[model samples]
Target: MKIAVITKTIITSFGLLILLAPQRTHAQLVPQPWVSVGGKDGDVTYSVGARALNWGAELGFGPDSATGFDLLKFLSLPVVSPYLGLGYYSEDKGLAVSGGVQVGAGDNLFLGVGYNSVRGINGQLGIKF
Candidate 1:
């Protein structure tokens, strides 16, 4: 019941973003490559990923290591951009649902915090190209 409500909310939100994005001429799809290293279950885990447009994918490693693919939609907001993702984690853990906000520090730098159902919570510091 809760998951169904959340999924509906996300789909509705993304639909709105798609409908409204075309009105903004300055909007650009920036390709970003990122590396994240954090701990899961007291062991170090890492991921390397790339994002373009409203989609992203990563390969994660640790005790509960898995390859994950996600669809992310970023809100067009100043200072902070909020995003949400739903992914399948294939390996030791099954599925992962995550969401986070990216705060820009410079042209190519941002910081993020996210939670994954299979891996718990993690922080990410990444450089966007």
Candidate 2:
């Protein structure tokens, strides 16, 4: 439904950016596509929102696999941006609140660390455009 549309839009936009501009795209390889996998030992719960200067949500993976969503802002800093987020995890019960910082190492390369309300700590590696 609406989720599919939004996903398509993002994909389309990213594709266009990749195709339309090669030099610039290769130089910045930003907003790179990424997915993360991790684990939490204790019981956990929380809800998350991820977008630039905005809040949002997802179904969540619960305790076992918490699919986290993060919002990346590039205006504040160069090579590094302020990261903010909230996510619904599976562990403790459900949703968990989280936030932190994101740093870009190079084109299509970056990593981040944030605090998870349920997991105690959360880490992620990502790419950008």
Candidate 3:
């Protein structure tokens, strides 16, 4: 199906980007990780994700399982980052677009709110290392 091809392409592109990313002197022990919960059409969905080098990926499970990838850009402001994302869900749901903002709760904790065409509104909690 068309969705299968698109999914493969996206996975390949993300893999290439990771492989070609520049190396840095300091390394992170762990990427920023988060959990998200949302609902759509009375069904709830749960997802997990991680962010690093301005890029993030997530996987959702429940009534509408999906995989998502995003690019996060941090604003000049002290504690806010906004992101735009694309996701592939069940056959019926197909593709979805999402956007959100994340605010740093402190030095290591963060909170986020986002909306997805298929997943509806979500709240996220994460930790930065």
- Please give, for residues 1-129, the per-residue lDDT of candidate 3 as tens digits: 999999989856754554455545353446889999988789897778887666677776546455444444322235776666777777477777676878999989999998878778889999988
Predicted structure with the largest TM-score when compared to the true one = 1
Report the poorest 10 consecutive residues by lDDT, candidate 3.
68-77
Kindly list the per-residue Cα lDDT of model 1 for residues 19-109, writing each as its tens digit: 3553245554777777777666787767766666545666666455566665555664666766666667777566666666667889888
TM-scores for candidates 1 onward, in order: 0.70, 0.47, 0.68
The per-candidate count of clashes, in order, stands at 0, 24, 0
The per-residue C-alpha lDDT of model 3 at residue 56 equals 74
Candidate 1's displacement at residue 64, Å, is: 3.3
Off by over 4 Å in 3: 1-30, 62-77
Compare candidates 1 and 2 on TM-score and give the better one: 1
Residue 66 alpha-carbon offset, candidate 1, angstroms: 3.1
Over 1-129, each residue of candidate 2 has an lDDT whose tens digit, in order, gives: 999999989856753543343232223322244333334666453333232221222233335554444333222345554433444444444555544556777765767665655555656566544
